[model samples]
Target: MTQKTENTQSGYWFSKIPSKNWSEKFFLYWSLVWITVFSLIVATEAYKVFYDVEFFILGLFVSLPCVVIPYFFPCAADKDKPLWDRYWVKANVWIALFGFVGNYFWTHYFFVLLGATYKFPVDFRLNEVPVFLYFVTHAYFISYHSATTPILRRYWTAFGGKKSTLKTIGSVVIVFAMAYFTAFMEAWTMEKVPYYSIQDRERMYTIGSAFYMIYFIISFPMYARIDETGPQKNEKWSLSRTAIDSLASAMIVFCLCDFWRLIIGSIINPTNSIPFLGTHGIKA
Candidate 1:
């Protein structure tokens, strides 16, 4: 078998020449369309928040794009291949499952422990998750694994000099920095939308961001190994393998987030909350 050479220019912004297959073209086009639509929703939310205006329909538009934007990036396994190709399909499935389950734990369960809860006025729920929020969560994972991580890795490898230790240290720093920014933006947006409320806003913002930082520390490195475009891409794809990897990633993130909850919950509100279990009572 001939050795596969990766495109040196491939990163967040560019991939190799896009597949000319009609199905692939259609998928890419619609992905861009949905991303634009979602951006509009985000923009509407921003306008309402900035102008201090209230609109009953605003919630409907707030989160749907977040789900679609992440899918816009091409999968590593088949960057220039048809959408129906086994690698593309399997990789997307892995990412979707990982995003959905991981987000559920962090958004629904973990946030409650930190004295925060999502307030979606539209009230669409699937098994107790807000439907729009589910999409938003999936989008977050897609964006990170597909786009952000690659870009960060490229730069870290470039700037960290020839030493492996420097590369390792730089990767960690980059991961933490990216995670912190993501968490900070999440906190800021929650505050802006008035979608979530916290008992101690200032402390939660700081601590919650750190909790996410730990999550990325584990996720970024793990993804680098399992990504379809990574070392395992040449291996035959299988449902069993995808399921196992996705479950493992979700479990790792869940445990890490909960571990932080345990440690932080004990210090912040041990009287009402159990360590590792999170805070008591649902927020109104």
Candidate 2:
């Protein structure tokens, strides 16, 4: 019974490294692969690779691998379970969904608040974002969360392995630091990409990272507990519960993001806009 209890609790937060299954390992490796591929594309200024292809087609090329791979990769935790029923695969799909939704709605905050610009070859857009970017964001979020998990686990252990007030404080500090680091890295890496631009690069790196960290601040920890400890002790989350939790995380971030816009406005924009009741502030 004790061993069964441990088995049920074994997941992202409960374990130091959560790649206990083939699907989990694949998620991590493919995330690295996507990051590497896009980094090279940016470093090489491979604009033709994107521009030559139809935006919709390119979107498919990026998206299909994420959808197709997990269904085939069986989880070691429960080989008898169907592929999609595994925890990591469900987590991947939901995170990818967040990526797509985030690009549609959350990105406009960057455009309005930080004076960011997208120089896409096509005019096709959803909520002022290039359509291909939705797919790109999907891949990026997978990579980001994949990288976030282990590091957070290590930090959580380092600070204190037990539940206590100090550990809680340490967890908050670690989360903020990790969130800020990842957000800044995201800005730094894509700075070379010609299609994406932000006004006042320095401010974007500094102040804008704090603003962007809001996304991970909510998402990172929320995602860690998806399959462990739910309505009942040691009970695994069902697909519906996994999705609901994922959507709840994104929605919380969405609300916090808009709240930032309403209360803080843009410090990165040259105009130094004041906060207002709208999605973005007007130049003062």
Candidate 3:
């Protein structure tokens, strides 16, 4: 088969070209739309055209494409399978589940570590935090993970050869660099949103990215493993397997974040509370 055909068949969602499956294609479009919308919103915010609540709501709306599309349109390879067995459905469910955990639980890490305050008020909330916050994180995560996949894939193809030591070293460097850059970009991009406030801008731009880096360090590689093909291909992931992987990654990050809190304490804010349940009651 041609290289192009091989890539298309690989079902690598990170590719610049569209995936062979409609479900992944739609998801790619969905991610691009939100990433663009987010950029536009950031631009508007820069011009004093603020719509913090509306923007978050839009994020929640756009995030549904991943979940909604898979129900009606399973990938071609998955047409004979059950709903949860479908590749797109499994991929979406995995990401949404991970994003949910991150927002519901890890949001507190931002509060305690970076002194992040969600100032925009909304009526619906789970534990004094906006309900849309959880879903909006889905959109953000889609973009972040999508950005990491292609770069890492390229690096792995080029440098991750038969040498296990080189592979390990290359993986470490690439993962750290990508994680740090993506974390800093998100923090910097949303820094001016008026609602998402951090105590120290300078610190957030610099050292704060390290704290956020923990999330992608765990997620980027793990998420890429979903529905693998080509040399990376093993067995396709079951929905159960997907959930287990995502949850395990989240748990690992949770432990790491708590470890950071315990050992280093808050980097941005010295007088922060580190509770097991996170900073929900800390009055963000």
Q: Tens digits of per-residue lDDT for model 3 on 3-55?
A: 75555445333433223245545666788877787677667664244345664
Between candidates 1 and 3, which one is better according to TM-score?
3
- Residue pairs in collision within model 1: 38-65, 262-276
- Residues 1-284 of candidate 2 have per-residue lDDT tens digits of 57544443442333422332354456677777666766676678766566525656756666567767655554455457765466666776678767866787777778777767677777676666777778777777766776676666655555433577887887799789989998999898778776777778898899889889999999888876666457763366777777788888889998998788877787664455544333353221
What residue runs in model 1 are displaced by over 4 Å at the alpha carbon? 1-87, 156-163, 226-239, 266-280
- Please estimate how well model 3 matches the true structure, expressed as its whole-model Cα lDDT: 0.71
* Model 3 CA deviation exceeding 4 Å by range: 1-25, 45-57, 73-75, 159-163, 229-233, 269-277
| Model 1 quality (TM-score) | 0.67
Off by over 4 Å in 2: 1-20, 52-58, 76-79, 155-161, 269-284
Candidate 1 vs candidate 2: the TM-score winner is: 2
Lowest lDDT sum, 10 consecutive residues, model 2, at 11-20
- For all candidates in order, the CA lDDT equals 0.54, 0.69, 0.71
Q: What local lDDT score does residue 221 receive in model 1, on the 0 to 100 scale?
A: 58
Clashes of each: 2, 0, 0
Query: How does candidate 1 score on lDDT?
Result: 0.54
Superior candidate under lDDT, 1 versus 2: 2
